[model samples]
Target chain A: MKVRHSRILRTAGDMLLPLLLLFSLFLLLRGHDLPGGGFIAGLVASAALALYIFSRDMRSARQVLGTDPRSLLGVGLIIAILSGVPGLLAGDAFLTSEWYTVPLPGGREFTLGTPIIFDIGVYLVVIGAVMTIVLSLAEAEERPWKR
Target chain B: MSLAVILPILIPLSAGALSLALWRSHLAQRLLGVFGTGALLLAALWLLQRVWLDGIQVMYMGNWPAPFGIVLVADLLGAIMVLLAAITAFAVALYSLATLGAEHERFGYYPLLHMLLAGVCGAFLTGDIFNLYVWFEVMLVASFALLILGGERAQMEGAIKYVTLNLISSALFLSAIGLLYGLTGTLNMADLALKLQDTGEAEGLVTTIGLMFMIAFGIKAAAFPLFFWLPASYHTPPVAVSALFAGLLTKVGVYALFRVFTLIFTQDTAFTHELLLWLAAFTMLSGVLGAAAQFEFRRILSFHIVSQIGYMLLGLALYTPLALVGGVFYLMHHIIVKANLFLISGLVYRLRGSFQLKELGGLYRERPGLALLFLIPALSLAGLPPLSGFFAKFILVRAGLEAERYGVVAVALLVSLLTLYSMVKIWNEVFWKAAPEQGAAAVAPTNNALLYAPAIVLAALTVAIGIGAEPVYRLAEQAAAQLLDPQAYIAAVLGEAS
Candidate 1:
């Protein structure tokens, strides 16, 4: 389970990690209107984290994340559930999406809606859940004596 | 009004999420577990009352038209099932507070339990077949985690069998859904019902898909030849989990079978129901026989779950109005009684430090209250008069006799005798016999109130169901009438325009 020290791989990982994270965010944002969505973005982000874990170690990966993946999962689910409440409050069915327009400084308008919020929640959950699984399995592998 | 349909699912889902967020705070998680389940019970009650008064209640998810988007529909049966699930969740939540160790609670027991409840409620309330499958997976994942929460050797073994078999069942279920969708071009169950009836040319292919569904749900319900997983795994979890599983899990499978057969697969009942009749007989015979051979408390009770499913299946297999009523009544009666018996078993374990019958005894002399509580569900399970099981069995037997299904009726009667034999075996060893000399060394826990309260309430409900059989019977009859004729459910879900 221990990873060997590889200078080239670590450098590659350092370069690729931020790029993958940025791309995942783009996928998540455009999910409502485009082909990409939260689920795929999550997988991509977790893959980036997995690369970091391999290059450095599980501890560094945990340190980079800075919080337990489980909390991310919890927050994600609550956000999704809350996203549905506005619809219910409006006397519509549960999960009914409502739209709003945001005007920026340049007078450009952006569409905001519950579906995108729901997709963000899905994005977080996918990342959190996949990372939780990958990290646990990797950690479990390190302690072969316990098994 | 629409909130009633979604609240049963949302309440548990929200509680689970909040519990996860508040995982470090045990007190908060515990309170959330209890109050959340309590809220679900109230919501389910409100839903049942609404359905009872207003006929089928439908909520189109996200305001989409039915047949195009998912819908949560609560007919009499769905509402009743949801209510029963909430009741079981509440009872188990209370019992879990006392029984679960701090280690397990910290490992997310409360959250997982609530998630399971949400899944069960969603399965019950959903009007779309694909949605039901999603709910089943949700329930399965939560249950898989709950089963192996402690990571004991035995639990791992049990969970492997449990998960492996269930995954296969899920695959079969998904494939059947895929095939059905391909044939009918619809996934909405009400719309599917309409389209399926119109597809006269594809009757044979439809029947094949129906059989696939039967086998899929049959495995879930632990019907005969597919129930080896139940006895192997159910007794391996902590008794609180066992009680929950015993109470609600298989019954959900039975509920799916009831819904599918009554609602969608009625075209070929001559073949499908006939198959169910034989499965019912064998499930009963084999289950009771398996219990008779077991000496462990929960294992015996576990086998009895499979056996009891037989009687419920008989109610469906008979396919008459009175027979369906009996099926519904048996469904309610079995859930209450089986769960009570499991809870009582947990109490006995606390007192004796073991679930092995040979190591247990003398409860009648030491704890008369526990003895009386035990006797209520035991005798009722044995179909003793003026108890819930008696009425459940009497109606099924009468329905069978009227239908002239003499062979299965004979088998049902025989299974009842054998069921009594197993209960007597537990009684003789665990209650009436002399306690082992070392048995007193295992000190009972101090929180006796929390331990006994749920069982006492459940036992009282068993007695109430027996005494108040008329109203419950009327509700079951109305549910049965609806199942026999799905036009109202179809209209409710797809609107009158359909």
Candidate 2:
């Protein structure tokens, strides 16, 4: 019953998830100083997962994505909240971003801040929240419930 | 110093995260929910004490100064409100432990509840209007998830109505904020106030935008013509969920209404406050009258919440110092009393195995002790003498008379009598009425003290606030005075680093 050309899209879907995941990580890491941030990265990751799920059945899809989205969401919240604690400890208000810089082998340098950590936390949460809804919708094959 | 305010919010949020991480473990959630809210309560009390000893406290976020950055401001009103929120959350958390069956717990209930608490605290403390919108959404999203968690048909139906209406309110709120920011060009409340004085000629435009806020917060507050969602959705949830929603959710709307109107939108009082007064009268009449026609247990209480909110709005609508104090006092008194009443309804459901009044009876012959617990809040809610509601109503009525707002005062008194009548109806049907001959099928009495403790604490609080009204009154008066003149708040927020 399936179309002959569908195999190409199915393979593409499988290939796309990893690439998308890698890009999501890139986005999350570079989010503080650039156009990419945790939320956008999470959305991209979720889009990749959604595509993968659409190309496969629910059980197999769940198997591929082994971790629970709800747990990811919780961990994300924990990280985000804890990221604020450093500011509190430094005797400023909660969530005041602190920073770090790493000297590269060349003359250039890399700098980071708590806001990035917070953004990563946001990234995890958005991915977790969106994927939870998507996977649950994917499971609802009959629209309300599935056998 | 900000730790006092920050911890009240952070403790719950972090606890939510930890518990959500351990979502599979019921034992972990139970321990975390109770202990976490306990920490929040203590922290809130400290925040209140600190604000009490000193004066208004403000903390800028990200080290940003007042005008440009978001700030958390804790005047007496915000401090007391945060304290109340923590207390209610703590009580409800304990109640949830005993009352939420495993299914509800497994459905991420604890995490959402904690998130809801964090949102409410954020709303109370935030000094920026736009930030308030974010907090409201945080609360809305958490509550929306909690509402539809079970995926029950009725829950979804109710949740859909709840979600749709709240979304509209939020959109209106956001647009109002957009227009406000466009108009004032500042997001912070103190800065907005400073800028709004120059909006002298734009009074009409200010009133228009202010009405947008009124309608938005009014929907959330469940005022007249906008409250249908509350009754439709509230009774459909499990009793524990309903209790939490009943206790905290709508009140947040009322709180926002009071906060924005008192702080930023005070330029055209005659028109805006006049509209509020009329809405307050209608909300009270309609809410109580709606309760009269409802035979279900939770539905009746649900309608009464609308009625009670009218009282709070009346306090704001009057806009006098004593009336404002009356409003603040009523806010404290009513939150404890209303929340306790809902918790008691959950207990009644446990005892009787049904929420329908027609199927229930005969508790008086057996559960006399439960009767006392019920009466404390019920009578207090009815404004019986020496209970918190009486003093709350008394101060409000006296203030109304002093202001010579005779018409609304008459409506308030008439509504009080009707409120008493409705409470008695619930009392007669559920507690005093004899069991029907064949349908005397009640569940075995639950000896679970955890189930009873939250209601007991709240009922005791109602009695305490009633018997010892002086200290509470003084606090409300102080809060009202500060609310009247935001000079101290402005100084604390905009004052040079001290």
Who wins the DockQ comparison? 2
TM-score per candidate: 0.98, 0.96
Best by lDDT: 1
lDDT of 2 by residue, B1-498 (tens): 477767777888899899878978989998888998899889899989999988887888877888888888888988898889888888998888877878888778888888899899889888899999999999999989888766778888898999999999999999999998888888998888777765768988988999999999999999987999999898887667777788778888888888888887898899999999999999999999999999998899999999999999999999999999999999999889888888888888888877888878888887888888999999999999999999999999999999999999999999999999999999998899997566534554568889888989999999999999999999999999899886677778898543
lDDT of 1 by residue, B1-498 (tens): 367899999999999988877767889999998999999999999999999998888998998888999999999999999999989899999999888889889678998999999999999999999999999999999999999988888999999999999999999999999999988888999999878775577888999999999999999999998999999999999888999999999999999999999989888889999999999999999999999999999999999999999999999999999999999999999998999999999998888889998889998998888899999999999999899999999999999999999999999999999999999999999999999877644546455699999999999999999999999999999999999988887888887334
Per-residue lDDT tens digits for candidate 1, residues A49-102, read 999999888888888787788767777888889889889988989999988899
Cα lDDT for residue B31, candidate 1: 96
- DockQ for the candidates, in order: 0.72, 0.73
Predicted model 2 interface RMSD: 1.2
Ten contiguous residues with the weakest lDDT in model 1 chain A: A138-147
lDDT of 2 by residue, A1-147 (tens): 132436777899889989999999998887877889999999998888888776765556667667788888889989888888888889998889988898898998988789988998898899778878987666564355412
